[model samples]
Structure formats: structure tokens, C-alpha cells
Target: MSEQNVIASLLDDLTQMQSLKTALCIGQDIAQYDLNKKIQWQYFNASDILNLPFTQRYDLGFVVFNDDLNRRSQLERGQIIVKLRDLWAKHVVVIAPQGDDAFMRSLGLTRIVDDALQDSQQTLWQFNILSYKNTPDWLNSKFWANPENWNKFRW
Candidate 1:
């Protein structure tokens, strides 16, 4: 790509990163205020800084998929969003990795960042903002909820 195209792509990617942060924030709030009644939290960090605990958590991470999960076709967009919101509302930290434009294109979304300039192979680009949700007491009441008794619908 020409230098101009590359620069433009990077800027576009940066913008997408901002959008992702906004989505996450909205997702987080929906979980706390709209969906899960028991959870509570506040926005604690910006997406760009990795020095803080927000950068430390590994259990939660997001990757923009190709939307090839045909098995998940029955699920509604609101359902997926609700699930994500619940997780964030529960204080689970997630990072939405920037994906390739081609991948994004396949999903009917455009790619923003270019990997060559950034010297990184991963598609996750941009530093947006980070939000937090309080952990629920029911889960912590046990090391792990027994699968036998757990309801698959809620889990």
C-alpha cells in the first residue's frame, strides 16, 4: 500500500478502536443497569494504558470473529450483546482485538488498523477505554459452581 493509504488505514483503525471502547462501555452499563440487577461498577481505566490491573486480567479477551459460527445463527444480536454486557458488568475485563480488514469485510465490517506499520501480527488495534463491574457474591461463595447443579441457560 502507498504511504498515504497506510496512514489512512492506521487512522481508521484508531477510530475503530474508539468505537470498540464505546461499545464496551455501553455494554458494561447495560449489564449493570439494564440486565443484571445485582451487579454494580464504574469505569476505572482508559483502554490505552496497560500498566494497570485492567491490562493484567487474562481471563477475558475479545476478538472480532469472522461470524462463521453457523451454529450460533439462532442467537440474536441482543442476546450476544447482553452476554457481553453481563460479563463486563460483573467486572470481567475484556479486550476487543482489532481484526484484519479482510476478516472484518467478510463480517460486513471494515478493518481500521494496518499491521505492517505497527510491527504487530495481531489484528487488535487502538487503545480506547476500560470499564469495570463488581463481581457477584454467588459465584465467589464457592470455588467453582458444581456443573451438575448449574443451569446451562444462566451460565
Candidate 2:
């Protein structure tokens, strides 16, 4: 193989390794959260979990907490929306719910796609706070970090 091909192969391997690590870390995080709740699996669909009343929303935030021994920080309920926005902006997750299709339609919200693994799907929605459809590089910039910009691009 040419030198360039060798370099490309190495890069691909590194990328896969990084993705594997991320998947592992995210999995561990979910396990820890579920353990805290005394549940085997704690992930729920975006639809079943969102559009909740204020009180219910707060409860949902608390339940997502990863209270594992390795988790020293408390769950940041206030920051959940911002995190979700980032996820949605990245197209890494959608906001589909698993129940009450008509309710979502009534509210004019698109149902979340349910084809992905439950845990994987939840991870995407858990981080999706904005309605933005495109994942732009500018999402990483500080200006776009503002919660106001979250509404700038709704799906």
C-alpha cells in the first residue's frame, strides 16, 4: 500500500477506536443511572418522555441521573435542555416518542423515530433540546451555545 493509504488506514482505526470508547462510556453512564433507580434499564422514548408538564419534566431530569459510584457530580437538571439542543442540532438523535402518536401530532411535533436501539435512541433524544434539523459546524461556537439560538432552527 502507498504511504497515504497506510496513513488513511491508521486514521480509520483510530476513529473506530474512539467511537468504541465513546459508546462504552455512554453505556456505562446509562447503567449507572439505571442502577441508582433500581431499574435494569432506564431509557425511555423521546415522545413518551417529553412534552411533559413542568413537574413531570423535573422528575424526568432527576430520573436520568447517573448515580454510579464513579459519578461524583450531581445531575444538572437546568442544563438538560441545552444538552438536548446540542444532540438534536447534531442529528445524532431524533425526538420521536413510543406512545400517543395523536397527542404528538396534535401538538404539531413530529414523532421520534423508533428504529434504533432503545438505549441508543434515548441517548440521542436525551441530548436533543432544540428543534434544529441541521448539524452545522457553527454549533460548536460559543455564539450558538446560547439557548436563544436553540429556537433559531426548528425542524
Candidate 3:
């Protein structure tokens, strides 16, 4: 199967495809997954960097690293993990060529598996930002030391 197809199929299995409401597609090629009518996709090519910072936030983001010579550093695109999560989306997914575990981890994304596409010969590596929701209890009003309850409330 083609590399794109393999990535798309794997995405179907890993995520609740129907639950995704919006996405920021960082590469022209990766943007092809827009076949899903459920998502409001904002597309951009690798070389276009200036407009990326202004893009609306999305539920997720996608990028496919390519060796295209014209691309402005595949890792520094119109979009890491786009360095995208926490900026453009709550989560991010990537499809890149194999062999950059340490480098990618430095960017805050983790591999989904060792062999992302077992049958495909292309050897694409899939990565995602494994994030934990931080709803800090101390930050919540119910747990806060409100001035009105200063004497009445006990630790």
C-alpha cells in the first residue's frame, strides 16, 4: 500500500476519527487526509511559515516529513509534536521517516509504536504528543483559599 494510505489507515485505528472536529494540516501532502467531512481543516505547505502562527486552534494537528528540496526544513514548517500542540491544537500527530527517536522526543512527541506500518516498506514513523490533562486542584475555585472563607475553612 502507498505510504499515505498506510498512515491514514493507522490514524483511523489510533484515534476516534469521528470525534475530531478540527485540524491544522502542516504539509501540502499530509493535507490530503481532509477526505473526512467531519473536520474543518486549515491547510498549509512546508515553506509557508509566516501565516502559521495566526491559524485558529484545532483539536489536532498533522505533519508528514518529506525530503522535498524546496521544503523549508521539514521540521520547521508552516507548522512539532509542530511544536504545534499547545499552540495550534491540543494534540498533534506526525508521519516521518524512521531514525530520529531522540530528536523527536526532544520536541515533546512520542512514537506510537516501533513498527508503525508493518507491511509497508517505506518505514514511516508515527508520533504523537502524549499529554496529560492538568486540571490543578489548587487552581480550582472550590479548593482555593478565598478571602471570605479564610477563618472558616480548615486545611
Q: What TM-score goes with each of the models?
A: 0.21, 0.20, 0.62
TM-score of 2: 0.20
lDDT, candidate 2, 79-127, per-residue tens = 2333333231221222332332453343333443433335432312322
The top-ranked prediction according to lDDT is 3
User: What local lDDT does model 2 show for residue 6?
Assistant: 29
A best-first ranking of the candidates according to their lDDT comes to 3, 1, 2
Model 2 clash pairs are 47-97, 84-127, 84-128, 84-129, 85-129, 85-130, 95-112, 96-111, 96-112
Candidates in order have lDDT scores of 0.32, 0.31, 0.57
CA shift at 76, candidate 3, in angstroms? 3.3
Location of the lowest summed lDDT over 10 successive residues in candidate 3: 121-130
- What is the C-alpha local distance difference test score of candidate 1? 0.32
Which lDDT tens digits does candidate 3 get at residues 17-130?
436777776654454544455666676655453444554677767766655422455455423444465566666776655555565655666667635455543344333334
Q: Root-mean-square deviation of each candidate, in angstroms?
A: 17.5, 16.4, 4.8
Clashing pairs in 3: 80-83
Error at 153, model 2, angstroms: 33
Candidate closest to the true structure, highest TM-score: 3
